[model samples]
Target: MRILLISVNRERMPYPVAPLGLAYIAGALKAGGHDVRAIDLCFSTDIEHDLTRIVEDFPPDAIGISLRNLDNLTYPSSLSYLPELEETVAIVRRRTPVPLVIGGSGFSLAPLPLMRRVDLDFGVVGEGEGSIVELVGRLEQGASAQGIPGVLIKGEDGFIPPLPLASFHAPDRSVLDNERYLKEGGMANLQTKRGCPFDCIYCTYPLLEGKKCRMRGVGEVVQELKVLQAEHGADYIYFVDDIFNYPADYTAALCDEMIAQEAVVKWTSFVNPRFLTTALCALMAKAGCQGLELGIDTGSAKMLRAYGKGFDKEDVARAARYCQEAGLPLAVYLLLGGPGEDDATLQESFALMDRLNPTAIIVMVGIRIYPDTALQKIAVQEGLIARADDLLEPRFYISPLIGSERLIETITEAAMKRQGWIVPGLEINISVPLMEGMRKFGLRGPLWELAGRMRRPRMRPLR
Candidate 1:
């Protein structure tokens, strides 16, 4: 069976991301003895021309489209990718009559809504590596894909629960042009693990990857890093795990393995402050961790509890101190205007950032509410959204107490006073041209450090 996998993600605001998920599915299919070809549309200038050429040349038996994001997630300047997705689907349909399948993090979030919105034969809810192989095999056999787990047929009322994988497939990085991503996107992405155990209210990671953390073997991770460096000329890597520091023992072992194997590749990942320690921080730095991004969500203790972050301000401070002592740059992410946001809580966040002085402070104003999250229930109870709202159009929950206008004003004012503070919500800084110019000059990794070198001038909030 010849399978055509298309990555339909084109969001390149802060930086473009290569479709690691699609590559995993392609790897799994190839390992299962199926011919797989992949196309990344992130840098595609003319989607119709490129897609038409591919379809004409390969003429696939089944086509799988990966949707990474439904919207930009930035408030005020939010852009929906649905139109682009529809355009891609239409182009593919006109080119061939092959089965169209959609599955990715974005489509998995609202599979039913997306299915209704666009014309698709099937949708895979959770991890598609296993399900996609089975789907393609079934289609090759000319059998009905009625009972496959995680496979949703067109016009189906309900879907079976997605099966959990014990381990991940060795992603076929060759399926896409990784060298281009390294040059344009700043860093190549790899995942050391899957799943999240945190109970953050507005998060969808637990829903997407279950609560259990599945760690890849340390040796395999190190080998993949080596391959990325040797075969692809990738110097910097960003681990796309939901939380790379959870299961502290596994993280420590992985870092040690990287050191033992002498992979010598610079990397960064999202780290939870709760499990971070001085020893672990030092080990990570020794293992070539260039930077760390902490999803602190908020700096106020009151808002931390309200947001179900499971960690307090003190934990964040301790983590910051450990990173500082280890000489590892830290980037802090904050999500304000949630359920308990107010002027005082906002002040607390700014004060904490000022005191800790991380390498970068990326702040977002509103919480994008998704279904099956604690946030969705709270939004319904508080009358922010109705029970039946599908939330497919990117509705955000901004605290009525703080108000959107005032929250933007306050954050913009505070960010202007500090260096290394970025507010994508305002669309003030981190332009694409600026990032491209930096990457062309051989800058790699998360360029947030350089992006935050100087304080940005005040600009009108994005309307």
Candidate 2:
């Protein structure tokens, strides 16, 4: 089957992302003896015209659409991409009558609702590699494609179960514009593993990729890094893994391989504070990791428990110190409001962030609730939202303990005093525009470093 894969992510606030997910699927489809081609809409000037022309010239028997995110995932603006996605599907449907199969991390979050909205012929929930190939076979044979695992059919009740993450491999970079992506993005991206084992309350990673962590071989990962360096001319890489440092041994082994091979690619990723060690921090820096995004959601231990994170205040502080001592740039990400969140916890978290004084602090004020997450359950039980409702349109769970108004006001006042601390949701934060400008000047690899370097704690009277 000839398949045309489309990447529908156009949000380029931080930077235009290379469609790594679709490339992986394209590789799998090719390995399965199928003709595969892809068009990344991230850089497309005209979505409809370009997409239509691409379809007109080399129409396929099937089309796969990858939706990487539901929204901007920022606050206040809370821009929804559903309408744009709907239009993209409409354009494709007008051009081709082939099977419209939707998959990707975002689609996995609200597949059924998205199906209803987009008029897709089918949806591939979670991982699409194995499911997509099996699907194409059935479609090509003109056989009943129903009951295929990991596939969601319109008007169908259940989907076929998905294969394990171990079955997937690193993405195929041939279909991508590596140089262009690297130029605009300031760095290339690679995924070393799939899945997230952590029970972060509002996280959608596990729902998208599953709870069990599945990793590519250390050699496989390093070899890809070498390719990025030599073939793609990639100097910086971002390991798009949801949680990179987990199962400590794997992280260590991967770092060791990079050291042994002397791979000349610097990278960064989201680090699980629970397992971070000073030794591991030193190893990562030695292995060409330029920075780390610390997923320390909050500082208050009580709030940490309420947020369902596995780490405590001590764990977070220890990890911060390790990164600091290792001289690794760190971006501390904090989600302030959740169940049991109050002014005290909020203030405490603020104080703690002030102490960490890492590279940058990204503050997300409200928790965007997704189906089946602990946050979603709490939102439903608290009558914040209906349990049966689809949350595709952006339903955020803000703690009533402090109220959104006061919470935003306090945080805004606090962030003004602290440079490099950004809240992109509430107001127009400087990071977005600043990073975009920096990218123009050829700076990349998680622009949070810019924010961190700009951070200068100002002395203010205690309230």
Candidate 3:
């Protein structure tokens, strides 16, 4: 089978993400004895022309498109990708009659809505690699892919659940903007693990990857990192795992393996405060971890409980102190004004944040409700949304008690005073062209950090 995997994600506000999902699917197809090529639209100079040329030159038996994100996930600024995706599909259809299939984090989050919104012919709900291979094979054979796990056929009633995320497929860089994404998108990313065990209310990890944590072998992860460092000249890497510190033993082993391999690639990841410790932080730093991004959620334990966070404010503070001791820059993420938010809770958050004094704080006003998250249930119960509301359109929960106006105002005011604090974020201070210009001058690892460092001189002390 001849396959074409297209990545349609062009949103790079925070940082452009590599199309690892598409790369994996391409690898799986290739491994399955199929000829595959991937086209990434992230750094595309001309998507329409390139896509047209590709379609005309190498027409594939099947085409799989990956959608990493829908809206920007920002509350008020909700920049949607539906129009762009629909246009992408229309362009492909015009060029060729190949069967259309969709998959990715965005597609999986609201598969039904996406399928309806974009009028998709086929989509894979969960894991894409194996499912895509099977789908392509079935398409090649002109047979039904009815019972294949993770395969979602058009007009189908149900889908088979994907197998445990134990198997790993290295990305197919042959069909990627590999070097460009590695450099401009901040850094190369390696998934050391899949799935999350914790039940966070607004998180889409569990919905897309499941609750079962399936970590790859430490040695395997390190080997991949070494290859990225040596072969791709990747100086820095980002672990795109849900919880890098979870299953403490796995994280410890992975860090140890990186140290053992002498992998010179510096890395960063999203760490859950519950599993972080001084020992682990030290190991991470020794293993070449330059910084840590902590998903602190909120500073008030009351709001923490409402957000379904496993760690409390004290635990958060302790984790921050551990990162500090390890000499790691810690960026704390706070999701405020959700189910149980008020002025008191907001005050408590800022008050506790002062105590923690993280290297950086990223604050978000409202929590977006996806189809199957606990936040969805809470939103419906709280009358913020109906149970069957279309979540693909970016509906958010700001807690009627606190109100979004007040929440945004408080966060904006606080963020203005607090250095290294970004309110209503998922953004960057510098422009893309300026960042790219800096990247050419050999700058990397999130431009926002530099912005944070520069702000210290002008930032006023929060009262």
Report the error of model 3 at residue 239, Å: 0.4
How do all models score by TM-score?
0.98, 0.96, 0.95
TM-score of 2: 0.96
* Most TM-score-accurate candidate: 1
Tell me how far the alpha carbon of residue 26 in candidate 1 is from the true structure, in angstroms, after superposition: 0.3
lDDT of 1 by residue, 1-463 (tens): 9899999999887888989999889889999999989889999999999999998899899999999889999887788999999999999999899899999999999889889889999999999988998988899999999889999999987899998788885799889899888888888999988888889999999889988988889999889999999999988999988989989999999999998998868899999999999999999999989989999999999999999999999999999999999999999999999998999999999999999999999888799999899999999999999999988998898998988999999988898777888788775556666667788888889888888775454343422
Give the distance in Å from residue 216's predicted Cα in candidate 1 to where it truly belongs.
1.0
lDDT leaderboard ranking: 1, 2, 3
Give the lDDT of residue 65 in candidate 1.
Answer: 95
- Rank by TM-score (best first): 1, 2, 3
Kindly provide the TM-score of model 3 when superposed on the true structure, using C-alpha atoms. Answer: 0.95
* Each model's lDDT: 0.89, 0.85, 0.80
- Candidate 3, run of 10 with poorest lDDT: 454-463
Question: Candidate 1, clashing residue pairs?
Answer: none
- Residues 1-463, model 2: lDDT tens digits: 8899999998887788898889989999999998888998988888988998889888899999999988987665589998878989989888888889999989989887888877899898888888888888989999887877788988776776676656567788999999998888888988888888878889888878888888889999899999888898999999888888987899999999998988856889988898999999999999888989988888898999988898789899999999989989888888887898898998899899888888788888788888889888889889999978899988888888987888788888888787778677764244455667788888868777775555453222212
For candidate 3, the lDDT comes to 0.80
Poorest lDDT segment (10 consecutive residues) of candidate 2: 454-463
